[model samples]
Target: MDIAARSPIGTRLNGLAAALGDGLRTHGHWVRAAQWVVVLVYSVLIVVPAVLPLPDETAHVFTHLTVFSQFVFWGIWWPFVLLSMVLVGRVWCGVLCPEGALSEWVSGKGRNHAIPRWVRWGGWPFVAFVGTTVYGQMVSVYQYPKAVLLVLGGSTVAAMAIGYWYGREKRVWCKYLCPVNGVFNLMSKLAPLHYKVDADAWRASYGPQSALQNTPPCPANGAPNTARTVRIQPVNCAPLVAMRKMEGASDCHMCGRCSGHRDAIALTVRSPNTEVVALGGHLATGWQTLLILVGLLGIAIGAFQWTVNPHFGEAKQWLAEWLIDREVMWPFAENAPWWLLTNYPAQRDVFSWLDGGLLVTYILGMGLVMGVGLALPLAGATRLLGPWHTQRFYHLSQALIPLAGCGIFLGLSALTVNLLKHEGVPVYWVGDMRLLLLVGANLWTLALAQGVCQRYATSRSRRWLAQAALLPALALVNYQWALMFWIW
Candidate 1:
C-alpha cells in the first residue's frame, strides 16, 4: 500500500473532516444559505426581467434610457448615499449590507486578517477624513443641475469599475469614494441599532483557556491558543487578552465575525457604558431607524415617477403660469407684448433658482440633515409609536429620524413628479439624476434599518446571513423598478 494513496480508511477520515468543516461549522451554513438565496433571486428577478422585456416599450425604453443616460449623462439622488452616512455611526453596515454579509461568510474560510496594530489604532483616520471632505464637495455640487448630472453620472461608472478592479484592498469605492457609502457613514449616528458585545463574555471567550471554553479563537486573529506570541504594543492583542485595551478598534465593521464562530454574541443596550471594552462587540444607535423610514419613502416616490409619471408636462405648465401669470404679469400690461414681460428680472430669478438651485439645494440640505441630524436627535416620535421609558428615548429617536426623513423626501418626490409631469417636461434620466441619488440613499437606509431591526431579534450568525441576503434583494428591486416600472 502506498503511503500517498488514499485507501478506504484514509478517504473516510478525510470525508469526515470535510463534513465537519461544511456541516458543523457555523460559518459554512451561513455562507451556503446566503449564496442559495442570491442565486435564486438573481435567476428569478434580474435575469428574467432583462430577457423578457416589459410590455410598455415606451415606458420601458424611458426606464432603460433613464438608467443608462443617468449613468452616462445625468444620474443623481440615490438612497445609498444616505445609507452610507447613516451606517458610519449606526449599525446599518454590519446589519444590512449584502457585501458585508458575503465577506463575513467567506471570511470563515480565511484567517482573520488583523490590520496592523498601528493601522487599527490611529493610522486609518485619514480614510474617514478624506471621505468626509469629498462628500462635502459632492453635496455642494448636487445643488447645481448640470454639475449634479456630470458628477453623479460620472461617479457611478467609476464606482462600478473600481469595485470590479480594485475593491479587494481598501474597499476603495465602498469604503472611501462612493457618495452613497459616505452618506450612510455620515448618517450612522442617526441609526438606533448597534452591535454590542458582552464585555464579560468577550473576555472569557478569548481568554487563556481557549480549548476549555465554549468560544472559539478570536475571528480577527487574536491567537487564542498560543504561548510564544509577542505583543508589540499594550493594545496589540484583543482587549480580553490584553486587559489594558478598552473598546475594540473603530475600523471594526461589526459583522459579528468574531462572535460568529460561537465565541461572541450581539448584545442590545439602551444606554451602553462608555468604558469601551476591547473584546466587546460593536454598538449601533437608534439613528438608523429614522434613516430607514426616510429611505423607504424616497424609494416609493422615486419608483412612482419611474412607473406612473414618465413626463413632467404639468410641472412645466404650472411653473410657466406661476411665472407668467403671477410674476411676469406685474411687469407688462394685458395688451403688452409677451416678450416684454418674459425677460423681466422676476422671470430670470425664477429660472435661475429652479434651473440651477432647485436640485442642489435639496441635495445639500438633505445631506446636511442626514449628517448632522443623525447625531442631534436624542428624543424622537413618541406619541406615534407609544410612550415608553425615558431611558429608551434616545433609542426611539434613532429609529424615527430615518423614518421621518424618508417620508418628507417621498412626499416631495411625489409632488415633483406630478407637478413636472403636468408641465410638459419629459422626465428624462439626465434631468432626474438628483432623484436617483435620493433613491439610492433611501434604499440603503431601509437595508440598514432592516439590519438594525434584525439585530434586536436574531443571533449573530443569522444576522450575518441576513446581511448577505439584502444586497441582491436591493439589486433586484432596483432592476424591477427601473425595467418593469413596478415602483411599489
Candidate 2:
C-alpha cells in the first residue's frame, strides 16, 4: 500500500528489503556464526589486553598488542559503532555485541525467571549511562588496561548474571541497563534505515482464519480441514520488543529477527529526521531529555574536557594550595587502587583522593550548568509556541541530538587521533574534519528544529518566534565545543 511499493523501482527495493529480512529469518545460523566471530574478537580485545604489560611510550599499535587492543576498542571500534547508529540503527548492538550475545546465550539456558520490577525501571538507562561514564573517567578506562578490564569486563559479567536470573533468551540488560542503551536509542532516532512495521498487515495476519489460510493442519489436529484455524508462532525477539507495535528505531535492535513477521515488518529507507520530526513529541520522555542535556552534552563533555581544560588544572592548583595552607594533605597523598581510581605508579598515572573528588564534582557541575543552560532556551521555545507544555519542550530538545551526537563522536575520535599521533601517523586534517562535522551537525540540528517547530506552530510568525528562542541553546552548545577545540 506504500507509494514506493507501487513503482517498478519501489517494487525492486521492496523485494530487496524482503529478501534481506527473509534471509535472516531462514538462515539464522549465519547470524549466529557472525555473532560468535564478533564474540571471539571481543573476548580477545577485552581479556588479553587487561593481562598484558602496558605498551611502552615507543610502542606503536601495529607493533604492540596492548596498544593495538586500545586502538581497536576506543579509537576504531567505539567511534564507528556510534556513527553506525546514525547510519543503520543499532545493528552493532544486535549483531556484533559480545555482551548482548553472551547475555542472550546464558539467558537461553538459565532460570528464566520473570524480570524484576526494579530491573525494568525507566531511569536505569540514564543512571547506568551516567554511572559508567563517570566511573570510566574516574578510572581512566580509555588509557589503562586494568581499568578497562574492571569497567567493561565487569559490565560483561554483570550482563551475563542478569541474563541468568532474568527473562528467557532476552537481552534484559541491553533493554534496560546497558550503559550506552540510552545513547544508542537517542542516536538511532536519526538512523536513515530501520525495520518498518505495517500495522494493517499485522492485524490482517492475526485474523481468526488468516493464520491457517496457507498452512497445512497440525498433526495434533489430526486432519487438514480448511475449517480449522491455528495461531501463528510468534517471533522470539531477544530485546522483547512488541514487533507488531514497534514504530521507531529507538528500541529495535535491527537484528532482523522479527523482520517480515506477519508480512508486516521490513527493512526500509527513510529520511533521517523522520523519527524525531514525526514521533518524538508523542514518544518523548523526561528521562530522554535529561539524558540528552545532562548526560551527553554535560557529563560527557566534562569527562572529555577535564584532561585538556586549563581551567581544571587551575582549579586543582587553587584547591591544592588551599588544602596545603590548612595542612590537609591526606587527600593529596592517598590514591585508590586501579580498579577504583586511575592508579598505575609504573605508568606515572594516578588519581589522588582530591583528584577523584574534584573530577566527580566537575563532571556533575558541568551537567547541572549545561542542563540548565540548554533547558532555558528549550523552555523558552516551548513557551513561545503556546502554553508551557512539557511534551513540547522534550520535542524541541530532540533537535539537539545531531549536535550532541556529533560532539560525542568528535570527543571519541580524538582518541583515534591521539593514538595515530603516537604512531607517528600524520593527522593534520583532524581539526578541519572536526570543524566540518561541527558545522554540518549544527546546520542539521537547526533544520530539525525548524521541522519540529512547523509541527507545533500554527503560524509562520509563531514558528519563527519559537526558533528564535532556540538560538541561544545552539550558541551555548557551540561555545562549549569552541572551548574544547579552539579557545582552549
Off by over 4 Å in 1: 1-172, 182-193, 214-256, 260-262, 267-354, 357-404, 408-488
Candidate 2 pairs with clashing backbones: none
lDDT of each: 0.36, 0.89
TM-scores of all predicted structures: 0.35, 0.95
Q: For candidate 2, report its TM-score.
A: 0.95
lDDT by residue (tens digit), candidate 2, 320-365? 9999999999998655887788888988888999999999999999
RMSD of each: 16.4, 2.4
Clashes per prediction?
87, 0
- lDDT by residue (1-488, candidate 1, tens digit) is 11114366545543443343334234635644665575354233223333332223233224553322222221212333343433333233433443333433333344344433442332123333333333323333312223333344345445444444432322334443433442344244443223334456655544555334443456688655454232221111111122223232233333333432323333222111121111111432233232332232233223233224433345445665787866664422333222211112322322333322333343334344443433333222222223433433333333333433444334335435433454456876533654565475445445443434343323555444434433443333344335323333
Among all windows of ten consecutive residues in candidate 1, which has the lowest summed lDDT?
A: 272-281
